[model samples]
Target chain A: MVKKLPALVGLAVLLVLPQVLGAEYSWLVLLLNRALIFAIMAIGLNLLTGFAGQISIGHAAFMAVGAFTSYGLGKFVGIPFWGALPIAGLAAGLVGYALGFPALRLSGHYLAIATLGFGVAVPQVLNLWESLTGGWTGVKPAAPYLLGISFREDRPFYYLILIALFIMAGLAVNLIKSRTGRAFIALRDSEVAAQAMGISLTKYKTQAFALSAFYAGIGGSLYAHMINYISPHDFGSGISMELFTIICLGGLASVNGSIVGAIFMSFLPKLTERISLVIQKSGAFEHSHFLQNVFKNFNQVLTGIILILVVLYLPMGLVDLWRKTKNLFTAKGVK
Target chain B: MAILELKGVTVRFGGLVAVNALDLSVEQGSIHGLIGPNGAGKSTVFNVLSRYYDPAEGTATFEGKDLLGAQPHDVINRGIARTFQNVELFKGLSVMDNLMVGQHHNFRYGLLPALLSRILPSVKREEAEKRAKALEVLEFLGIAAYKDAFPAFLPYGIQKRVEFARALVSQPKLILLDEPAAGMNEQETHDLAQLIRIMRDKYKTTVLLVEHDMSLVMSICEHITVMEFGRKIADGTPAEVQNNPAVIKAYLGEEEEAANA
Candidate 1:
C-alpha cells in the first residue's frame, strides 16, 4: 500500500479540468485547491507527530505565526511573496525550536496540553497586539513576488499553492526517509533504548521539533498566499482543532494519511449537502424528522467517533491497515 | 592499564544506599564480570558508568578522563556504549534499521553530502554502503534473515543478539553489557558466550558485563569483579575469585562452600 504505485494518478486531471470547463464547476475546483494546500499543513503536522514522534497541539499557532509573519513582511517591508515566503517559515521554525526546549521535557498528553495552551494564547495575543498585528483589523497580503504576475483569481492562487505544497512535500518525504527520521522514530519508541544505541536525545528531539515547525510554517505561507488576507480568527482555536482533527483522522504516524484526511475533510460538507439534497427529493428522509436530524448534525458526531475509534483500535493508522490487507492477498498460498 | 575506574562511589536514594563507597576498576581489552545477588547494586554501578544516575559521592575515570560530568551521549561519544539490564531495544524498528541508527554517531556524510545523495540517482552510494555494512553486521550476528523484522517479533535471545550487534556498530572502545545473558536459555547463553569472545577477538572490544549467571560469567569472563551490597568483595582471575572466601560467602551459602572446599 505504501509502495507508491501511481495511486490516484488521474486525480489532478479530473480536478483541474472542471475549473476551466464552467462557472459553477470553478467553485468546486477552488475548494479542491484549498484542500490540497491544507494537505500540506496536514503533511507537516504528520511529520512532527507521525514520523518525528513529537506531540504538537499548538501546530496551528505556528501556522498563524507564519501567516502573520508573511503578511507583516509583505506589507511593511514591501517584501513580495517570494521574499517573505521562506522568512515566515524561518521565523516559525525559530519559535518552534525555542518551544522545543520546554516541550521536550513533557510527552504525550502533557505535551499536548502545553502546545494546546500555546495554540490558545498565540491568536489572542495577535488579536490584542494592535500596533504590529493590526489587532482585530486583519492584514492584506501583498501580491506574488513577480511584478507582472498578480494572483487575482483562484486558479492563479491554485497553481502557486500547488507548487509550494509540492516543494514542502518533497522536502518532508526526503527528510523522513533519512537518518534524522530514524532517530525520531527511535526516540519516540523508547528514550532509554535510543540513548543506549548512542543517540543524543536532546539534540534529535529538538531537531524534530524545529523541522516539524519549519514544515508548518511553509504550510502557513502557502495558506496566506492562497487566501490573500488573514485575521486572528483565521488561525484561532477552530484552526487548531481542525488541524488536530485532520492528523487524528488520517493517522498519527503517516504522510499520505494526511493527504487522504485533508481531501476528506475538505470535501465532506459539500458531499453532505449534496447527499441531503438527493435524500430530500426521495421524500422519506425529508419527511422523517429523526432521519433529517441525523443527516444535519451527523458530521461533527461522526468526526468525533472516528477520532475515538482510530485512537483505540486503529492506532497504527490507515496505511498499516492497507498494507496488511494487501499482504493478506499477496501471501504465498493465498493465490 | 585500567580502562574504567570507580573510586569511593556511593548512590543513595533517600535512606537507601544502592551502592556505597564502591571502588573498582576494569582493565583494557578484557572481559570483566560484575556479579551480585538481587539488588546488590550490580546494575547500579552500570547505571553510574552510563551517566544515567549521578553518584552521591564518587570519582569515575574512563581512560584517564573524568566520567562524572559527561552527559549520557557524551559518554557514548567519548567511546563508551552500554546496554540495559532489561533489554531496551527499539521494538518498533527493524533489526537492521536499529543497527543503522546505532551508527548514527559515526555517520560519515556531511550536511552537503546528505543533500547531494538525495538529489543523485542510484541509491546515494554512501547510504547504500552504510546499509550494506549494517547487513554485514547482521550476517556476522547470524540474524540477517531477521534483519527486516521488527525487534518486537524476534525471540528474546535473538533480540539480545541484535542489541549487541547494534552496540558493536558504533565500534566503541568500551561496551558495558548490562546482563547480556539475563533472559537466555542454556543454548542461547552458550551462544552469547561465544559471541562475546568473538566480539572481543574480532573488534578488539573491551567488555564489562554485569551478569547474575555465575556459570556464564565463569565460562566467558577472563577477570571477575564480585560485588556485595554495592561494594567490591573481590577482583581477580575467575579461579582466584572462586577460591576467595569473600566471593564464596557472597555468591554461595556455607553448605555449598563446605562441599566445594
Candidate 2:
C-alpha cells in the first residue's frame, strides 16, 4: 500500500488540476489534455524504439493513418467515436505489421531510412487523396458524446484523455513484464541468444511494431476528437521529431519517462514563448536588429542546447534523474 | 542409445570448409566432450546441431527426429539449449529474469493471454508456476543469492554459472556447453567438472560439452571426440583418445610440449 503513495498523490493532483487552474486560465486544461494524449503515443513509441531496439523516424505516419482512419470511420461510416478509436488502432497496427517486414531484412540506418520514407510519403499521399482526406483542407470531427454525457467541455475531455493515458500506460507496463516483453528485451540485447532461447525473431519484431502502432493509433484517434480538427500538417515529420524528443527527454525504455516527456514537450514551447516575449519587451537588443532577430529564435536555440546537454550528461534521461533524486530524498529517512 | 546423431555434416564458408564431413553421436544420459585445436571447428559443429547454420551437406537427428526440419528458434522447444562461447546474458535484466527467460517454452501463453492473465486464472497460475520453477533452478545451482543482481555486476565465474542455471531451468533433454571452463581458474575449473557430473547423475540431463581444458575433459567426460581442421581426428573413450597417435600429434603433443617448457 505504501508503494502506491506517489501514484495516489499524482492522481490527486491530476483530479484537482482543472478545478484549481480552470478558474484562472481555461486554455491550460486543453494543453494538458493534448499532452496526456501524446503521452500515450510516447509510451507506445518507447516500447518500439527503447525496449525492442528498433529505430524508427516515421512514427508520425502511424498517427496520421490513425487520425484519418478514425475520422473516416466516425464521420462517414457512422461508427460512434467510442468504436472508431479501436478500429483506427487496428488499421494502424496492420500497417505497422507490414512495416515490420522491412525491419526483418534491414536494421539501424537502413531501417530508419525506410521508415522515414514512409513518414515523408504519408502526408503527400493524404494531400493528394482529396476524396478521402479532404486534401490540404483536412476535416473536423464531430464532438463526441457518450452515454448522455457530453465531452464537449474541456474538463470532461481532459478527464477522458487522462483515463485513456492511464489505461494505455498500464497496459504497456503489463506488457513489459510479460513473457512477450522479455522476448523483446532479449532480442534487443542479443538476437542470437534470443533465437537460441526459442524466441521467434520474425514474430516478436513485427508484433512490437504492431503494438506500438496500436498505441499511436489510439492517441491519434483521441487527438482528432480533442482538437476537433486534424490535417496532414498536424502529423508531419515535425510531430515525429517532437515525439522522439519527448522520449529522449523522458528517458528511453521507461513508461513513466514517456509521460514526463509529453508533459515537457507540451509546456516547454509555451514557456519559451513567454520568455521570448519578455526579451522582446526588455529592449536589450535595441542597438542591433541582428541581435533582435537572434533573440526572437532564442527559444529554438535553447531547446537544442538542452537536448545536447541531456544527451551528453543525462543520457539515461529524466527518469534516471528522477530515480536518483528519489533515492537521495529517501536516504534522508523521508519514509 | 544415442540422443543426438550428426551424420556426414559438411559446412563450407565460400572456398573454405569450416567443418568437413563429420559424424558424431552423443549417447543419452552421459557426459560427452568435444575437444579440438583453435580452428578445429568444434563450435561449427554446435552451430550445425543447434540449426544456427544450414550445413552444405548433412543430417542431424535428435531423439530420432530430423533436427534440420526445425528452425533455429524451434531448437529450444525441441528439448535443446546452448550457452555461447562469449557470455550472452541480457545485461540490463536481473539474474532471476535471465533464468526465467530460459523457461519461456514452458509457458505456452501468447500475447493476448498474457495481457489478460490478470483476469484469467489459468494464465496467472502458469506465470506463477514458471517463476517458482525458475527460483527452484536458481536454488539448485546455488546462485539464489545473486538472483536480483545484474550480469555486469557479477564476477565472470558467477556469470557463467548463471548461464548454466538459465539452461537448466528449461530442463532441456540435452544441454550444450560451449567452452564452459574457458576462463576459469584451476579451482573453479574443478568445481565446474564436479557440477557437470552432478547435472548428469542427479538431474538425469545429457550434457554435450566443448572444452579446451584437457584435465576437466579427461576427468569428467565418459566419451571424447577429438577434431583437427574440422575433421574427426579421433573419437572413443577418453583412455583410447589419450593414447591415439593422431590425437597426440594433432592436439595433445602441443599441450605436452607447453607443459614441459
Candidate 3:
C-alpha cells in the first residue's frame, strides 16, 4: 500500500493535467503528449539495448514502418486508428525480427552500423515508394474516434496518448519481471551461462528486437494520429539518435529513467528558446551577430555537453542521480 | 546402469589435443569426480557434455540420448545442467532471479503469456511456483539471505554457492559442476562436500564434478577418474585411485626423481 502512493499520485496528476492547463497552455499538453509517445519508444529500446545488451541506433526505422503501415491501413483498408494500431505494431515487429538476423551475427559497433544502415535506408525507401508512401508529400491519418468520443481535440488526444503509454508501460514492466526478462538479462551478462541454463540465444535475441519494435510501432501509430501528418522527414536517422540519447540520459535498464529522459528531451528545445528569449530581452548580445547565431543553435550544443557529462560523471544516468539524492536525505534523517 | 557415458571423445584445437580419445562412464545416482592438474582438459570434458564444445570424434550420450547432436541450450532441457569454473552468475540479476533463469525450461510459456502474465492466473501461478522453488533452493544452499542481492555484491564463495543453487533449482537428472570448490576456504569446502551429497540424495540427481580439492573429492565422490595430458591415467574408487602408481606419478612426479633427491 505504501509503495502504491507515488504511482497513485502520479496517476492523479496525469489525469488532471489537461484540465488544469488545457485552455491556457494547450501547447504544453501537446508537448507532454509527444513526450509520452517518446517515453513508450524509450522503454522499448531500453529492453533491447539495456536489458538484452543489443544496440540499435536505427530504432526510428521501426517507427517509420509503423507510421506508414497505420496510415495505409486507414487510407485503403478502411480500418480505424484503434484497429490499425496493433497491425502497424505487428508489421514493425516483423521488420525488427528480420533486423534481428543481422544482430545474431553481430554486436557492438558492427551491429550499430548495420542498424544505422537500416535507419538511413528506410526514409529513402519511403520517399521512392511513391505509390504506397505518397513519397515527399507524406500522408495524413484521420482523427481517431472511439465510440462517440472524438480525440481530435488536443486535451482529449493527450488523454488518449497517456492511456496508451500507461498500458504499454505496464506490459513492459511485466515482461521485465518475468522469466523471459530474466533470460534477456542472463544472455546479456553471460551468454555461456545463459545457454547452459536453457535459454536459446537465437530465440531471446530476436524476441527482444521484435518486442521492442512492437512498442516503437505503437508509439509511432499514436504519433501519426496525434500530429495527423507523417513523412520521411518525421522519422529520419536524427530521430533515432534522439531516441538513443533518451535511453542513455534516463538511465539504461530502468523504466522510470526512460520516462524521465523522454520528458527532459521533449522540453529541451523549449528550454533553450526561453533562455535565448531572456538573453535577447536583456540586450546582452545586441552588437554580436556571432553570439546570436550560437544562441540560435544553443540546444544542440547543450545536448552534446549534457551527454558527455552524463557519460563521464553519472554513467547510470539521471535516475542514479535521483537515487543518490534520496539516499542522502534518508541517511541524514536516520542519523 | 550408467547415467552418462563418453566413448572415444577426442577434442583438438589445431595441433593440440584437449581430450584424447577419453572414455568415461558414471554410474546412475552416484557422485563422480574428474580431477587433474591445470590444463588436463577436465573443463574441456565438461564443456563437451554441456554441448559448448563439439568433439572431433566420439559418441557422448546421456541415458541413451545423443548429447553431442543437441544444441548448448537444449542440454538443460534434456535434464542436464552445469556450473562454470569461473562462476558465470548473471551480474545484472539478483540471486533469486539467477535461480529463476535456471528454471527457464520449466516455464514453457510464450511471449504472449509473459506479456499478459499480470492478468492471467496461469502465468501468475507459474511465476509464483517458480519463485517459491527458487527460494527453497536458496534456503537449501544457505544463501536465502542473499536472494535479493545482486551477484556483483556477493562474496566469491557466496556467488559460487549461488551457482550451485541455480543448477539444483532445475532438478536435473545430471549436473556438471566445474571446480565448485575453487574459491572456497577449507571450512566452506567441507560444508560443500556435505551439501553436494545431501543435494544428490534430496533431489535424486547425479553429479559429475571437476575439482582440484582432493580431500573434498576423495571424501564425497563414490567413483573417481584421473586424467593427465588429455589421457585417463586411472579410474577407481577413492582408495584405489589414491594408491595407483600412475595417479601418484601424475600428481607427485616420478618415484625415481624423488628417490634420487
The alpha-carbon RMSD values of the candidates against the true structure, listed in the order shown, are 2.9, 2.3, 2.1
In what order do the candidates fall by TM-score, top score first?
2, 3, 1
B189-209: candidate 1 lDDT, tens digit per residue: 888899899988988979999
Clashing pairs in 3: none
| lDDT (tens digit, per residue) of candidate 2 on B1-261 | 999999999999999898999999999998899999998999999888788899999899999999998998999999999998989998867898887788877778898865555657877788789888888888877889998999999999999999998888888899999999989999999999999898777778999999899999999999999999999989999999998878887865677756656
- Candidate 1 — which residues are off by over 4 angstroms? A6-22, A143-147, A285-295, A302-314, A331-335, B108-117, B120-123, B253-261
Q: lDDT at A24 for candidate 2?
A: 68
List the lowest-lDDT window of 10 residues for candidate 3 chain B. Answer: B252-261
Report every candidate's CA lDDT: 0.79, 0.88, 0.90
Please rank every candidate by DockQ, starting with the best.
3, 2, 1
Q: What are the chain A TM-scores for all the models, listed individually?
A: 0.88, 0.94, 0.94
Q: Candidate 1 — number of clashing residue pairs?
A: 1
Model 2 CA deviation exceeding 4 Å by range: A1-5, A287-290, A330-335, B252-261
Tell me the TM-score of each prediction against the true structure.
0.92, 0.96, 0.95
Candidate 1 scores an iRMS of: 2.4
Q: In candidate 2 chain A, where is summed lDDT lowest over 10 consecutive residues?
A: A1-10
lDDT of 1 at A194: 78
DockQ of 2: 0.69
| Candidate 3 ranges beyond 4 A from true positions | A22-24, A285-296, B254-261
